[model samples]
Each structure stands twice: as C-alpha cells, then as structure tokens.
Target: MPHCVILYTPNIEPKTDLGALCRKLADTMLTVRDEAGKQVFPTGGVRVLAYPAAHYAVADGKGDYAFVYLNVRMGAGRSAAVQKAAGDRLMEVAKEHFAPIFEQAPIGITLQIDESPGQVYDGKHSSLHPLFNK
Candidate 1:
C-alpha cells in the first residue's frame, strides 16, 4: 500500500486545492516504476488522502504560517534508489502544486517515504485489487 497521507495547515486550504494535490500525488505514485519498468506500487492499493489540521502551531505563532507534511507508507521490497526516486518525484509535484501559494504566503512542505521492514503487522481486506489485476 503506497498510501500518501497529507497533513496540511488549514490556512492554506483557502489558497490552494488540497483535493487536486491528492489526485496529482496518487498519479505520481502510479508512475514510479521498478528496474524492469514495471509499476513499483500496485494500482488498486494506492491512496492519497489529505487532512487539514483542525489546530496547529508553527515554529512561532507570530504570523499566519502554513505547512504540508506528506508521508508515503509502502511495503518494503525495493532498492533505496527506487524509494528516493518516488520521494523525489512526489516532492517535485507537491512543490509545483503549492508554488503559487508559497510566493504569497509563508508555507513549508515536507515529504518522507516509510518502507515497512517486515515487522509491522498488516491486515489485508480489499476487493479493489482484483479489479486492477484484471
């Protein structure tokens, strides 16, 4: 599951489109391919969800500041290069999406990729995978 969870500041919601950003992120995830050029992440398990923090405090509560923390979680099995590529691509897309707002407002964006190390317990129950496999 390459689930992208976007935690952004509420202030930016008015200046940007979080829903469109999520869709773009999901699209970027699908473009991440392995060495053989096969998709690195399964299509059906991809998820991009954004949640604006109901309340948050920036580094200093001086001015109206905003931030977007994007974390991409996936099952481990790929090389570091692949992970880096995905993170780089995702960050690039996110940065481009928020460029306009960044020019007029003080906002920050952070992206991280967390690959499972085979220790975490993951339960599976999804009918969507079958559709994609076909």
Candidate 2:
C-alpha cells in the first residue's frame, strides 16, 4: 500500500483544498508505470490523506507560516528507481496543488518515502482494484 499522508499547517487551509489535493496525489501515483506501461502501483493500494497541524514553527518562527510534509508509506519490495519515480511524481503533484497558496504566503514543502517490510505490513482488499481496472 502506498499511503500518502500530507501534514500541513492550519493557516493554509483557507486557500488549500486538502480533499482535492489528496485525490490529485492518488491520481498522480497511478501514472507511475513499468516498462510495459502497466501501473507500477496498484489502484486499490492508493490512499491519500491530509492532516492539519495546530502548532508549528517554520524557519525562525516569523510571520504567518505554512508547511506541507508528505510521507508516502509502502510495502518494501520495489526497486530504488521505482521508489524515486513515485516520490518525484508525488512531489510534482503536491507542488502543483499548493502553487496558488505559495504565491500568496510563506510556505514550505517536504516529501519522504517510507517503507515497511511485507512481513510486518499486512492487509487485504477484494474490491477496489476491479473498479479501477474497468
């Protein structure tokens, strides 16, 4: 599963549509492809969400500041290149999502890819993928 979590400051919520951003991220993740053009990430495995941070500090705590921290957690097995590709795409979508807010305020963005070995990460999904396939 690639669970994309966006941790952002509350100050940006007025201009930022978190739900739409999540959907964009999930859609972007699906664009990552293999040599045969198959989606590298499973449709059912995509999950994107955002959380607001009540208290935060950014670069010396001056003025009204905002930040978006992205953490993409996946089950470990994919190659490093695949991970990097996914990360690059994630950041691209994130930056695009927040472009309007960035133009008007002090905002910071960061992204990281985290992995959990299959042994410890367990889950089952029976329906979601089929809907996407069709």
- Candidate 1 per-residue lDDT, tens place, 1-134, comes to 77999998899988988899999999989989988898988999999999989989997899999999999998889899899999999999999999999799899899999988966578889999999998
User: Could you report the Cα RMSD, in angstroms, for every candidate shown?
Assistant: 0.9, 2.1
TM, every model: 0.97, 0.85
Cα lDDT tens digits, model 2, 1-134, are 67888898898988878999999998888788865676777888798888998788888887888888999987767778888988888898888888998889988899999988746547675688788777
lDDT of each: 0.91, 0.85
Candidate 1 segments whose C-alpha is farther than 4 A from its true place: none
In model 1, which residue pairs have backbone atoms overlapping below 3 Å?
A: none
lDDT of 2 at 10: 91
TM-score of decoy 2: 0.85
lDDT measured at residue 3 in model 1 versus the true structure, 0 to 100: 96
Identify the candidate with maximal TM-score. 1
Q: After superposition, how far is residue 121 of candidate 2 from its true place, in Å?
A: 4.8
Model 2 lDDT on a 0 to 1 scale = 0.85
Task: For model 2, state the Cα shift of residue 50 in Å.
Answer: 0.7
